[model samples]
Target: MSNTIYKNGIFGPNEWAVLEDEADLPESGKVLVSPDRFLALEGSAPEGVELGVVIRAGEKAERLVAHLAKLPMVAIDFPKFSDGRGYSSARLLREKFGYKGELRAIGDVLIDQIPFMIRCGIGSFEISHAPTRRALEEDRLNEVPIYLQPVGRDGEVPLGTRPWARRRVA
Candidate 1:
């Protein structure tokens, strides 16, 4: 019943602990905090504790713009498969704000949407779906090789002179 954390092209353990609003911060560990808590803490957690923010649905990623440089990780909640706002948030964080740290997606992460998520700059995923977990564990995900829109990530080649049509180089 453990959740699988897929990162850097491999499925492994989740190292960061998610903290509730009322929970006491650990003295030394990686912790994911809500936006309000993150703001309240002002990006300052206990010594030896790495701070990360979980940007939930309906929350704007811009709120974290000032603190992006200090954050080692940022997890965007999917909440549901149909909610695509996290994609835009990821893109903005990577492309606009230039957040080079680990961008993670949590909840409702499906195999079909993983490729697209990667394109949007999500480097890790906290996956709970059994089928998706199996796909990652087996290294057999169904994905489209070609992409029409450019996401500004490396290894994406333009298909032709159109400038919009592109394909992933991998």
Candidate 2:
């Protein structure tokens, strides 16, 4: 079952669907992973193999950016129920690294964290298989209206953070 955390009144994941080694990965399509297991090989990632990383909080997120900048996608890990590291990490990945690809939540994905995850720049989520009633309650939290503002404002000033704030989405 997936676990979720609250961020800015919304719920999100602790980690994501990560494959351990190359054998655990498929030849094509998207493959999830954690930072610790990522093999630093330029062009080693097979064609059509969209590798992802499951960051265990925002601790080394900034440092990993230069390395992750080469990848296609990354997922943040939340560990425990109260862990907010993934939330902060997601924000940095988007604002600092300028990751323009997909950011998804894989582990402990409850309902309430969805909205905040989106604000933090997460575009996809892996909902749990056996969600309890608590999951439903949390999910409703994200259902509220979200103003056009990404999570942290460059970790300093919060202003015009939306990627499309300057354009019209019709």
Candidate 3:
């Protein structure tokens, strides 16, 4: 699954040149790759190739905390929409480990899931299906405003400040 649209299509000029398995590393440019490739390179990633990692669904994203400083983007897979583990992984990366990079949700991505993903601190979405692309493009996806609780590491005003919200910062 590929062809990502960041910020629910609200932002642009963020087009990514993602590196897939068995692909050649570009001579110069930011690139996103899989977790195995990042770990395989150790801390010696090729110069000029900005390194990013995509953690598969169900994988332990926390394992990469030590290397967070080296990453500008981290994608957590959602191989199946029913697999909700990526939500936790995303939260841990943002709230606990303090990952400030572009946190992406990839694979099996759907329009309805976008709002929830954002609440979990996912900043981008890798949308491969045409239906998802259409929904997002048309702004038909469900929108959840006035959250009762801020679930991730976002700058939500504290409980007393916002009557309808309570953010638990880890």
Residue 163 of model 2: what lDDT?
51
lDDT of 2 at 8: 41
Kindly report which residue stretches of model 2 are placed more than 4 angstroms away from their true locations once superposed: 1-17, 21-25, 67-69, 129-170
Report the candidate with higher lDDT, 1 versus 3.
1
In the range 38-93, model 1's lDDT, one tens digit per residue, is 99997467778888999999899999899898889999999999999999999999
Point to the candidate with the largest lDDT.
Answer: 1
CA lDDT, every model vs. true structure: 0.86, 0.61, 0.77
State every prediction's TM-score relative to the real structure: 0.87, 0.61, 0.75
**Residue pairs in steric clash, candidate 1?**
none
Residue 102, candidate 1: Cα error in Å is 0.7
Taking every candidate in turn, the Cα RMSD to the unseen true structure, in Å, is 2.5, 7.9, 4.7
Clash count, predicted structure 2: 16
C-alpha RMSD (angstroms) for model 1: 2.5
Ranked candidates, highest lDDT first: 1, 3, 2
For candidate 1, the per-residue lDDT at 162 reads 50
